[model samples]
Target: MQEWFVDVAEHIADGDPIYLACEECGQVALPPRTVCPDCAGRSLEQRPLSETATVTAETTIFSSTPRYAEETPYTIVIATFEEGVRLTGQLRGAETVERGEEVRLGVESDGDHWLITFTPSD
Candidate 1:
């Protein structure tokens, strides 16, 4: 699982974030996985994901894990893309995000790794 996430970060750093979709069931998995969670399909293929998504849910984090403890009071959001896939990323470039707000996906280097981020759009 950690390697899967690392691949996602690397892809984002390359400016081409991608997700894995099960060839048999069409279930998309962010961070790419060998098996589809929805159907247990083994043949997964890389799929292009949109750079824009809509905020579907959000919350202010007053506390966070050790990795993000220094960035408390930050916002995390669940954004849904055109691929019908939803991903969770830290919200940026806005103090507040409302449900259904449009957001553009982005990546940021966090020392040794990259982070998934989203900024308000229009």
Candidate 2:
């Protein structure tokens, strides 16, 4: 995994999530980036994420490799933040969710790694 990705997760675990915004084109990216993907601008800043996101897509995985078999039947969602950045993460606090549903972004740590988590907004 990318170091920047881990950094973002760590921030979330600490109650702060961030998105990288381009100082030039105003484009935003969820995972931190050194340069703007749109304008190739090197001036990017870390901005606090909206924390809440709207579910745009979802799916449930019933089968997976042995490493993830213990966590089978998990739900994954693609949620859009207020900044227009879409983030994909594991769904928590519910077995499933629908499009347009509200969810809060968070982080889950499992010893050596961090993962993005999306739980019901309320």
Candidate 3:
């Protein structure tokens, strides 16, 4: 797990927000990809992501999920970036975040890993 976290941090430090690319089809996907759903490609490329986006959807989880008790009722948001990449992550620093709200990327350390968060745009 430590190695995984290190890798993730390194990846984030090297290039972020990462994008997904299909090696077989040479198609560039805005959000990072594990395998190309369109082409079944096993190879992928991680590319830098645009910093700005708009919230498309959001939900707050109040249940006692492990590792997130302090952040219960935390906002989880899906955002579509200016580059047309759609991604989901925790929404931070807002009591209420709504759809179509502008957001920006913020990084948070989770002890084990660094996770991305969306903050309300100023």
TM-score of each: 0.87, 0.95, 0.71
Q: Using lDDT as the measure, which candidate wins?
A: 2
User: What is the C-alpha lDDT profile of model 2 across 1-122, one tens digit per residue?
Assistant: 77888888888888788888999899998677787999999999889888899999999999987877988989999999989899899999999998999999988777787778899998
Query: Where is the poorest 10-residue window by lDDT in model 3?
Result: 1-10
Query: Per-residue lDDT of 25-103 in model 3, one digit per residue for the tens?
Result: 8776744456787787878876566776899999988896687898788888999976566767789888779899999
**Native-referenced Cα lDDT, model 2:** 0.89
By lDDT rank, best first, the candidates go 2, 1, 3
- Where does model 3 exceed 4 Å of error? 1-15, 23-31, 40-44
lDDT of 1 by residue, 4-99 (tens): 777776777787878888999888887577789999989999977788899999999998889788888899999999887788889999998999
Against the unseen true structure, what C-alpha lDDT does each candidate score?
0.85, 0.89, 0.73
Candidate 1 global lDDT:
0.85
By the lDDT metric, which is better: model 1 or model 3?
Answer: 1
Q: What is model 1's C-alpha RMSD?
A: 1.9
Span of 10 residues, lowest total lDDT, candidate 2: 107-116
Off by over 4 Å in 1: 65-70
